[model samples]
Target: MSGTVLVTSRSFGSGGLDLERRISDAGFHVVRAGAAHELDELGPVLGDAVGWIAGTGPVTERHLSLAPHLRVVARYGVGYDKVDVDAAARRGIVVTNTPGANTSAVAEHTVALLLAALRGIPAADRRVRRGDWSAWYTREVSALTVGVVGLGRIGRSVIDRLAGFGPRVLGADPWVPADDPLFDRLERSDADAFATECDVVTLHAPGGQTVVDERWLAASDRPVLLVNTARADLIDEAAVAAALRRGRVLAYAADTLATENHGEGASPLLADDLADRVIVTPHLAAQTREGVDGMGGMATENLLAVLSGEPPVNPVPVP
Candidate 1:
C-alpha cells in the first residue's frame, strides 16, 4: 500500500482472478477508476497515482498536468490514438501498449461477422422471432472472393481461418513487401484492385483518418459486404451509409463503431432502418475471456516494469 497504481480498464479483472493481488504482489496499492474512457472522474484520482492502465480514453496533456506522481500510462489495447505520446515523453513519462494481445479475439469475431452477414443470420433471426416462417437467403460465404486490407497479426489470423472455408483470399497491404515470405499463401492485390475484385471486403488495416471512403468501394464489380473490427476511423461512415442505401455495399459488420457507446444513439450505420443491413457489436470482439486476461496481464506487467526502474516490455514508438 505504498505507491499507488490506478487501473482504469473496465475489464481488468474480468478474468475472475484476484487482479488486485497480482498488482499488490508487485508492491503497489491498487486504485480502481471506473474506466479510462470516463475522463471526467479521473481528475479526483490522478494526483497520487504513480501508474495507470488505460482503456479507450484520451490521456491528454491536460489530464497529465494533474498527475504529479504518474510514471507510466499503459494502454490496455493496441490502439494509441487516445493517448498523447509526445506530451507524456516531454514530461518523461513512459507510454506502453498491449499489442497482439487481442488478435485471436478480434480475428475470430471478424470471421463470425462475415458468416453472419453472408448467411443472413441476424436478419433471418429477426424474421423468425417475429413469427415469420418463410426463409430468405442472400449469398454463400464459401463462394465469395474475400479481400483483406491489412496483413498484420490480426489480419493474417483472419486469412488463416478463411482458408478452411474454401474461398480465394486476396491480401492488400502497402506496408508489407510484395515478396515477403510471411504471405506465402495470400495472393497479393492492391487496395484498388481488391475493392473491385473482392465480393466480401474485410478491413483489418491500422487506425487512421478516413482510410476507406466512398471511393474505396465505389468501383466494386459486384455488391460487397464490408467488415471492420480495427478502428472506426478506417472507414467513412457517411459514405458507407450512402453505399448501404444504394445497395452497392450490401452490409456492414463491425465490432468498433464511430462511438464505442452509442449513448447519443447509433452512429450512421446503426440506424433503425439499417439495423437489418448493419450489424454492430458493442466493441466486444476482444472482450472474450482470454483476450481480457491477456491484455490485462500485459498492461499490468508494463506498469510494474516502468515502476521497477526497468524498461517497459512494449514501449510505444515516439512520434
Candidate 2:
C-alpha cells in the first residue's frame, strides 16, 4: 500500500460491501478508528493517512493540521455539517459527502416515525407487552393536514410518500423557488403556518437552525404530532418536552437527540413523564442496508478520486 486511509465510520462496510478491500486494492492501507474522532486516539493514525472516511464526529481545523499526508475527507453520509470543509480547504484537503445516498432510507424512516407518533405505536407496543389489550385511539393520516419542512431531496421524497395517505400536504422551504412544480402537488406555507395549521409536522430541514422552539410551539392552536428524522438541533428538546407536558405536542418522535454520544440523561425529552408520548431512535433513519451500501460506495469513490489526483465526485464547497 502506498498510504493509509483512515476509516472512522462504524457503518462504513456494515452493508457487506467490502469497502476496505476496495481501498486496499487501490494501493492504500485501511486503518480503523473510533467514530468519536478523539485527538489523542487519531494523532498517531493522522500522521501517515492519505484519506479519511469520517463519521458524525466533528473534524476540526486541528484535525486537518495533524493529517499532513491527508488528501481527502470523505464524509460517510449525506450531511457534511460535522466536517470542517473550510478548514480542510485551507489545508489543501478535499472534503466530500455522500449526497442522496441515504435519501430514500431517511424519507421512508421519516414517514415511519410520523405514523409511529400519530398512532402511538411505541406506547401501544409497550402496553401490549404489559398484558394490556385495549385499543389505542388514534387519528387517521387521511384526516390530518400534514406539513413537511424543507423541500430538499429527502423532504420531497417524504412528500411523495405522504401523497398516498390522502392528507392535504403543506411544504415549507425558503430556499425552494415559488415557481417550482412541487407546489402543484402540495400547498406552500411558511414556518409560522406549519406550527398553527399543521396537524402533523415532519422536519427535514438542515442543521444549525432551530425550527421548533418555545415560540414556535406557543404559536400552535392545537396539539400536533411532530416527527424528526433530520438533525436533532432542528427542535429544542426543552421546548418539546414542555409542550408534551402541556399537551401542546401530542407526540414527539425523532431519530436523533442533542446528547447522543455523551448521554441520553442530559435530554429533557427522555423524562419519565414523557415516555408514553416520545419515541427516540438511535439516529438510524439512514442505516438501512441499501443506504449503508450507497453511502459507503460514494464515500469510497470520492476518496479514491482525490487520492489519485482527481476532483472528488461530491466535494463540499468551501465557504
Model 2, 101-149: lDDT tens digits are: 9999999999998898888888899999999989957999999999899
Superposed Cα deviation of residue 126, candidate 2 (Å): 1.0
TM-score of 2: 0.97
Model 1 per-residue lDDT tens digits across residues 1-319 = 3588888787887985666788899888888876534557778778888998988767899889889889999999988887999999998899999999999999999999999988778998999999987876677667889999888899999988998988988988899998897568878987788767889888888776565687875777778898998889889998999888888888899888776742555588877888888898877889988899888888988988899899999999999
* Best model per TM-score: 2
Error of 1 at 109 (Å): 0.7
TM-score of each: 0.94, 0.97
Q: Which stretches of candidate 1 lie over 4 Å from their true place?
A: 261-265
All models: lDDT?
0.85, 0.91
How far out, in Å, is residue 29 in model 2? 1.4
Q: Between which residue pairs do clashes occur in model 1?
A: none
Q: For model 1, give the RMSD to the true fold.
A: 1.8
For model 2, what is the C-alpha lDDT against the true structure? 0.91
Q: Which ten residues in a row have the lowest lDDT in candidate 1?
A: 257-266
